[model samples]
Target: MTLEARLAALAAAGQTITYGKLARDLGLRMEELTNALERLMEEDAAAGRPFRAAVLRQRLSPEGLPAPGFFLKAAILGRPAQDPLAFTRAERHALLPFPNIPG
Candidate 1:
């Protein structure tokens, strides 16, 4: 499956994945994953969809939040993210209403 489809499935299931594991599963370098996610974020923004890339967290992220690059991409896409945790939570929630989950 494509990365977007995979991410959408994870979002629908209210699940999150670490960036490292996702990268390995997709046979991608970290940079490649980040670039792809940024493009996805841009498309999501244009399409008025929730940021599916928000489901990608850092391995060491205690709250299951995506890496800083996610936020940067969001900002570049004209999404204001003054609060990273809330922003990601809301995006994930939009995809699937798991309000208590962080990812």
Candidate 2:
């Protein structure tokens, strides 16, 4: 399945995936995955959809959150994530019609 499809499924199931695992699953390098995620973020934003990439997390994330770069990319895309937790929470909530994931 595509990255977005995978993410959508995970989000619908109230689950999250680590960046490393996702990269390995897609047979992509870390950099490539990050690049793809950033592009996805931009596309989602432009389409007025929540970031499907929000279902991604860092391996050692403190709150099951994505790496700091996720926020940085969001900022670059004109969505400044001053509060990372809050931002990610909202994104995940809006990503799917029925969001079962908690912040």
Q: What is the lDDT of residue 76 in candidate 2?
A: 83
Displacement of the residue 66 alpha carbon in candidate 2, Å = 0.8
Displacement of residue 100 (Cα, Å) in model 2 is: 10
Model 1 per-residue lDDT at 24: 88
TM-score of each: 0.88, 0.89
Residue 97 accuracy (lDDT) in model 2? 66
Model 1 spans > 4 angstroms off? 97-103
| Candidate that would win on lDDT | 1
TM-score of model 2 vs. true structure: 0.89
Superposed model 2: Cα runs more than 4 Å off: 99-103
lDDT of 2 at 14: 68
Q: Give the range of the ten consecutive residues with the poorest summed lDDT in model 2.
A: 94-103
